[model samples]
Target: RMELLEAFKTYFQQGVANPPGNYTSYIIKAENISRLQKLAELLTKNHIKFAFGGNQNARGFNYDRQKEESFSVGRNDLIVNLHQPAAVLADVLLEPKTLVSDTNTYDITAWALPYVYGLNAYASKENLKGLYPSLDLSMDQDAKTNATQLPLAWAFSWGSTENAKLLIALQQANIKVRQANAPFTIDKNDYPAGTLLVMRAENERLDKELAKTISKIATSQDGIFKTISTGFVDKGKDFGSDGYPLLTSAKVAIVFGDEVSSLGFGEVRFYLEHDLNLHPTIISVQNINSIDNAQVNTLILPSGDYKDDIKEGLAAWVKRGGRLVLIEEAINGVIGKKGFDIKKRDTTTKKDDQKENFGSFANKSKSNFDDAIPGAIYKINLDATHPISYGIGNTYYGLKTDDLIYKPFVQGWNIGEINNKSLMAGVVGKAVRKSLDAGLLIGSQDLGRGQVVYLATDPLFRNFWEIGKTLFNNVIFCDY
Candidate 1:
């Protein structure tokens, strides 16, 4: 649970207006056996006895209240973390769903705490060093960011969610922030595009208070105010160039109601409130027309059907310089409508599927079952030259659940697209896989003064998908 919360922090999410969530959780961090033995030693010294499960000294869990009495436990379910994860994934992909159960299953069988919680993991073929003398569960102290002396400006590489949190913090503090649209080198250190610059000249009012304010922000969000001294770079845009665009804090709104996906809505809500220290307006599709762009400049629509009377108004609003963001199925509705050139990739084929398997009901049921995509990982080709893809790499791992595809983004900024629909993880069906092969996943165009951004998948999917979290908020923060 703490790790899950840490993941949120790593994404640089701070003061995000989070809906109160309460649940039972425990972190099983076994760095080494000695740590467990040390814990056992302490517990035993205090007259508390326990049994070690899943070890060489493995004994069935049975604990007694008295010193000599046998061990006892209440009803419980023990779930071991799936190590060497390839085998199960292969089974799900290769085998038919009916092989596991012909009847409709209660829910998706996949229960992964790691990816679901947005925790990072690496599958190592070799074991890591596991020697431990003691387990230090100590938290990090408030190491406030202190500078020896302020340079012409303070520079921060736009990497991690922490930098994102800092960017919003500086914006909120009225400290003039600028983002470099091109990669730069300063003090022999190279920083990529989207590097943040807080010019000392712009914020003369924050002369002495600048570092102090940054410290407060860091302490509050557990942020790392890691900065590089700003100077004339060897390559790329200079500090005084127009290549660096001034950035403003975002006034965000997430579309809520029966038409939207609650999961999608909640993820964005949690991210904005907790990660970026912003409380987004929770407006409904019913209030689409009523959305005063003055109050909420940025509107995000999570995956759902909203092509009613509201969608047209919403698209019109975008042309008026309102920042409009769409995720997954929501894009399905508004494609080829107004202010967007994205066309939905047809799921239907010339040869009728039903007609081919007309006599076979079982075959038809199997085919229908196979079409479902329960969060498959896809590799996207991102054109990082665009500001939307800033801080994000050339390739993005998109977790695609919906097979919502668009024709090649001939118009606007084709920031992200799937060339081959690279399935990195999870099971993808024959039909959906083919359609997902080559299409635009993320595209944006300037609609009038406003902009319309289309996302083929929700970047804030289940509050997992780390890059998506950054990319989702990028719509609000990114200059482009």
Candidate 2:
């Protein structure tokens, strides 16, 4: 308060002594006029000489004619509306990244994203005539799609009994079905019950490891055979005839499961088929327990939804030096009983008490951009410089304490201590046990012969496609 008072006194004395010339535009908001009044008091009390407009333009305070008047201050004066022209507020809040002559190029989606999108929204439309006039409408478009519909199981034979039921419903609806490896093992005499089988490319230019998987599938008695992968596309001439019918026309198709595809796999498909000039033949699998016949370069599990078999596979894979990406939910669900334990109190089972385990639907989805949440983004102090944050801002993101049910993973990430509880901004904690010296959130740990990069947030291109697209590219695609 004293500091602000002193600043006002300084400005007030200066303004009163010179009476602010017409060359300067003294803009003020309605709510902030009180500050101006305080400053006026100081000037009057000190009896300092001042002016309102300049000597040449005595009536008009020579503000730039090009700049539009944001408030109803009229003619010579200008008003700045905080809510209406928030971009101007942000412009004054965040310092723009300085241009460098070195290799440090600015990332479009990483460093200058959310703020850019936010400011662009709050900027007056008329004021932004030439700057991205096309996206003016996108600010009002509804981007939220309800995830109410239960995903149909096109290849139910590969999943559990519940999966089978889902597949049957889709089939009855005339949805195309495909069969892959079953989540559970069946008797050798068991028949193929799936709707369709999607053949994956065994030896595409990028997937050289698929040859052994294809050979294994051929020798197996699962009868869950698939056609040649459309990923092979023209490389395999018999797509319509011998290629995976699911890729071409099956109303319901079963592809491989992966952590990267947990949210929207359609974008990758679009990119592959259109942007990258390649066909996408893989399917995203939530549970990896059924994929024994295929060989994968990396096996990913997005936190809490893991099975015993999947864990076993992951353990073996990690031991054998394969890549694995595990989200926070998976770590809490499978590995240890440490972090936020949503498991059970004493002894509780679903059959014993229906209210005990309500499944994934019980938890509500937390909004990342909601301003109601305090500390939607926590400032992370990192170690020196790292690769993950090579091109990102000096600060990283954390969970907002304001979000319902979402809690932070770090101690210093909290906003305030209230009622004996620490209110933090970031959710989802990663388990770290290491002896080496490196950064925590954006650090890479050498596991066995391979490496594991631990990012607090799922920087997957799929999740933050809009705001952090370039950041994702730097982490996933860039060799640097």
Instruction: Report backbone clashes per prediction.
Output: 12, 31
Q: Positional deviation of 95 in candidate 1, in angstroms?
A: 18
User: How close to the true structure is residue 72 of candidate 1, measured as C-alpha lDDT?
Assistant: 23
lDDT for each residue of candidate 2 in 1-480, tens digit (9 for 90 to 100): 999999867764554343221222223211212222333343345442222211121122111122333433312112222222122322232222212232212222122222211111112222211211011212112211111111111111221112223333333433443332111122222222122332233223343444343333323322222222122222222223432224112111123344433443454344334432334335355444333323543444443344333445444544454444444344334334222212211222236433443446433332222122222233334332233332233433332222122222242222111111221122221111011012233333444543333333443333322213323322332121
User: Which candidate has the top score in lDDT?
Assistant: 1
Off by over 4 Å in 2: 1-295, 307-309, 319-321, 337-375, 398-443, 460-467, 478-480
The TM-score of candidate 1 is 0.71
lDDT of 1 at 335: 59
Give a tens-digit lDDT track for model 1, residues 108-207. 3332332222222222222122223333333222123344356576666564466677788778777888888898887776767887777777786755
lDDT of 2: 0.29
For candidate 2, the 10 contiguous residues with the lowest summed lDDT are 429-438
